[model samples]
Target: MRRLYGHDAVDIEVATDTQRSRVADVLLTHPITQRRVAFEVQYAQLSVAEWRDRHESYVQQGIIDVWLWGHTRIRRARSEYALEPYRLDDVQDELRKAGMRVTFINPESSQLAIAVNRFGRTYSLASEREVDLVAFELESIRLSDQGVRSDAIDPFVTAAREREAALRERELEAQEHAEARAAIEAARAKKASARDLERARAAREQFASMPARVDARSGVVRPSVTMPARVLCRQCGKPLDATLAEFGVHLGPCRWEQERLL
Candidate 1:
């Protein structure tokens, strides 16, 4: 299409409002093959006037073959078998007069076997085997399998599109899962940080509540000395039980104060 295969397969600069043949949704041109394949995808039924108008535009634009992918709607309607039958007849007549060749790629087993729609005064002669997009996608396919058949292009492009779409969907799902995990980890980290803060607060409170003794001699202070927790002095950087306070030295002084005393 113009969006994906613009510079590679399609020519966008060649467009105009008056000509109305400006550009197609997808156009694949091979310089060596001298082949220009164009597509007109139809997701819904096209009335008689719209069908003929579009056919003429494709032919005049020097496109090799035209593919009309009829969307599945009203499965059992006559329009399901053929679209704008009368209009197709008129368009074919005009194209034949202009010596233009047209082929129809209808996605039906019966149509494939017959390969022609000779509706009584209602349609033009066109190959009928439509490209089953879904089956063709799910099935293993090769580009070289169809030798110069325009019909093959429809299915090939369809499969390529479906595969690409599925891959993108999976990638999006994986990204979503990764984002979810990051959010969960962030929340967990915050919870753990809160718990650590609570433990720190409780520790500070217990240390403040515990009784301490300061040795006036060594400037060493000891907390409520215990076997394990708080066994180190809160001040003077000395073991609680081994501090000046435990040694009953009342006139302890740090080096800074000792120098002043000297």
Candidate 2:
């Protein structure tokens, strides 16, 4: 502690109160802000209740409480068959649910490690990684109502936001493409309608200019009407069989030839 901070900035086994006092393992006072941070190193298995009691005690005195657990209390996840220390996952989860911090420090290497889930990511099993302790110490000056907050470097939230934005952009592009196709289809349908109308008008004129047909049985001249011609009946104002009408021998009443016009 003295090497990390200055000689006067660190204190050992500081008592919070005179009677029924709670002792801090190591107290570090910031030289500028004068904010106090108490670090408690626990190697033995400590229950959630006992840890909470000690943590709350420091908070009540306006001191930031930082807990560093050894392998017996919290260990890294491993897959190989080897003797490993039992880690208290349930205890850590309960504390985290109450917005308390859970961290680990290797007793031999003194390396600090934090859970990967705290960075807003997940895995099949719980995993952790060693963090830069100097950066964490500098950022620890920022406080919350609980006196201390998790200072893990977070990037997952930013990545998630970027992904959501990209999805929305793609959806918008798809909607625009559908609307463009519909517009093109509507224009094509209008052009086809106009062309059909023009063809119908041309068919009407073609029928009027056709030469008169001669009846074989009566040997009389008559206007010819067929499936490909368009001639209107003077009586019904519909298509008429001109040859039958001229001969006064109507085979059938006149009807419009819609297919020929188109």
Candidate 3:
């Protein structure tokens, strides 16, 4: 793996004391991007928590960590042997949570195998699929910005910058759309409030124009009504009573208008 990665301008077995005191089993550094990748070769039995802790520490230091399980052939069924670690499912679960894939290097064939799906426990052999190592290096380079040379920009850096710009533009556009929707909603609410106020004012005006009336037999006051007379009360054409100042210009009390105002 080191020899293959070397051709792609990646340095292996690099030492780092920032996260841990120990030397990494395999470290791949991109020359142009200065992206760092630490490959952990897990041969012995290690707990899932410990694995995650180490991986997280590397992540905090802005390093991409790849776990490489030792070549241990464990029988899953009668004839098939699962090429994974002791606690394959648990380790793979942790890897899946971190959005990473488990790697295995076949000692005999010197071939690389990657676990594509942890749930399905499926692996694809690199040699069989003709996976390009150079392409993989470029991908890793795009992940890290540490130690990147600013003197000259590579194709990968340009592409990464373009992707970031596009992502920012999309987020800005979404925010603008949300603000526009809120503004439209506010405008509609304002219009609705204005319409309600206009309706209420029109109802008050119509009620004020109506004339008061009274029952002849009971002598009780009745609701106002429209009438033809101009000088007298418009309701029943009745003359305004001087004693009933509360009735305004009408002959009877305007009880409904007073109740509505309250």
Candidate 4:
């Protein structure tokens, strides 16, 4: 298994000294990230307490440990099953707690088989079902050269960061476009205001030029009647300011004119 999957990335029978004691087993290490995996082989009978102690020691050191067992079986009902019992009082409880499972090596087929406990629901007097022992054949166990079981998560993280950057760039561009549009709108409003002021001034100038008239009964010149001023450009409908030197300039020559002659 080590030659086919682990290759040069992993070292066999590596000795690691922890706070409790030294552990010698198959040490799988990722070539790039240097993550470690420990495999422990147990052929002799061990108490449940002792197994838990050894498993917890490696776990405390942040190392993943896989327990391999040979010729270990737990009986359930009338048949003896190779898998660990589902009962809470059994040693299988300790194995499940340690996140480990017992694997059996078949000498005849030269293959690895894992014991699995399954439960079925049936319409009967018993609401709870019986435990069915099943053996699953492990066709292959391939580990990456990088020590990663499958693919690395770094690429997914990198892609997410790139997408976030692109979203921010789009937001910034939208903000710039909005600001430019607002500036254009402000310029238009200012120009329109200036044009209105010019038209009012032109109307006032026209009103001041009217001649005075006399009252027939008082025999006196009547006060000059003031009329509302109108100061529109003759060539165009646009308003103009009487104070400007080019107030009488044709619309075609005006700076504010939009159309041009060919």
Candidate 5:
């Protein structure tokens, strides 16, 4: 096998004379270091039958990693022999349980699934998404003009994190909805988010009838509208511009004023 794969490791495939000898169909050894590897191949047609027949060959070698490969669909589908150290079906089953879209489809009767979120795109299983965000926020420092750490970095950061944690605890305790942000920019963010959400919902509602475009990444920014831009008209349907000319009061506007706000 080593001769075929052209690895620097040397492979020795041997049969055991004694019943106690651990058997490796292809025992790979690092040429110079003499590191030994006992590789086993089990087909979809034959797995434990093969392993049980070969297990006694490696017992004297102590611990040997078995690489199970080449199994048939009929052979790989059954879990009656599952609790074995290596099985393709176990990996495939767990991936299905995790609700991931990907599965093993190779012809070798091999299935290996490490879930999408578990694939280590970022942090470990213990600290997954936002671990970096939390770490960055925790380590945030405000440098002063004098090249010293500003007082804001200390008390302000600590207070903000404590406040956030407290909010999360309260939200969890109450079994409430998503916790809203409390940052100074939160009000503007909420307004922008609401506008975006409304736009998406409306677009989705009329998507089938909407015209197809070339290249497709185009949008328009809506002008800002706040309570200050509008005043209630007591009589007419026109939007009363907040014109405080006569006195400090916004009386209202007549119908011919053009813009309307009810």
Candidate 6:
């Protein structure tokens, strides 16, 4: 620790001024920023509530606390929903919510390992959902207001953010497509309705223009009525007058059907 930061003011198990007696495992004061950082090596199982309480204590005194969990302690936390062979640490999520950083160091190897969440992809195998731990040197650790900031995790964090942005963009595009389709369908329906209304108006005008005609059956003089007219059939070669137009169907046989009628 003295060789890395050139800080001769490193102390072990130091007490800070607070309402409650707060002891930090290892404390080092930054020479330039005058900021103090406390490093806590957690070997035993610690509950989230207890961890939060301790973290809050340091925060009250304006001290940055960095936590390094024992490998077995961290590995014990497993996700219930995720498949076997890969398990997420629920404690990590809680720590993230408080803007805290976490790392795992085995007693045997004494190497630093960072666990990062995977995003923007599908995981088919159970092992794929497992914790992905990247090993980095302790030299990468830097002190920040948020806690110990490391460049080792920067790539993973950036990738996750990019994936989230891409997903949001895709959703927006899909919504736009649905709205456009609805608009096009409404326009088409409106056009068809207008065309039908124009056709009916023209038919009415053609009927009203005809001269008076005699009724074939009763020999009565019938006045021309301003009603819609329709062609009986293509082969019949005549449109129905006002009285017969209401039927809309061919009453008499056309040349094509005359042979069948006989």
The per-model lDDT (C-alpha) reads 0.45, 0.56, 0.52, 0.51, 0.37, 0.65
Higher-scoring candidate on lDDT, 4 or 6:
6
Better of 2 and 5 by lDDT: 2
Cα shift from native, residue 224, model 1 (Å):
12
- Per-prediction tally of clashes: 12, 0, 2, 2, 12, 1
* Best-fitting candidate, scored by lDDT: 6
Per-model TM against the reference: 0.32, 0.43, 0.44, 0.41, 0.26, 0.54
Off by over 4 Å in 3: 1-23, 27-37, 42-50, 59-64, 68-172, 217-262
Question: TM-score: which candidate is best?
Answer: 6
Off by over 4 Å in 5: 1-13, 16-22, 44-59, 71-87, 90-262
Q: Give the least accurate 10-residue stretch of model 5, judged by summed lDDT.
A: 125-134
Can you write out model 3's per-residue Cα lDDT over 57-125, one digit (the tens) per residue?
Answer: 787777777675665722132323433322234565566455454455555555444433122232222
Q: Which pairs clash (backbone N, Cα, C closer than 3 Å) in model 2?
A: none
lDDT of 4 by residue, 1-262 (tens): 4554458766667765644284646777656666667767655667888877877777777677765554344334442553334322244456744434434444446444343342232111111122233333334544443222212223332443455577799999999999999999999999999999998888666556643332223333423335333344544534455553245434356544535432
Pairs of residues at least 3 apart in sequence or in different chains that clash in candidate 4: 198-240, 198-241
Clashes of 5: 12
The residue-by-residue lDDT of candidate 1 on 94-195, one tens digit each, is 433443333333455412111223334422223332211122221121112221233433543344445557779999999999999999999999999999
Q: Residues 100-145, candidate 5, lDDT per residue (tens digit)?
A: 1111123332332211121223311111111111111212222222
Residue 147 displacement in candidate 1 (angstroms): 21
- Judged by whole-model lDDT over C-alpha atoms, candidate 2 comes out at 0.56
Which prediction has more favorable lDDT, 2 or 3?
2
Tens digit of per-residue lDDT, candidate 6, span 202-252 = 877776665544333334344444433233433343556557655643565
Q: Model 3: which ten-residue window has the lowest total lDDT?
A: 126-135
Query: Model 2 over residues 107-162: C-alpha lDDT tens digits?
Result: 56545554433223421112222211212333333333444444442332234345
Comparing candidate 2 with candidate 6, which one achieves the higher lDDT?
6
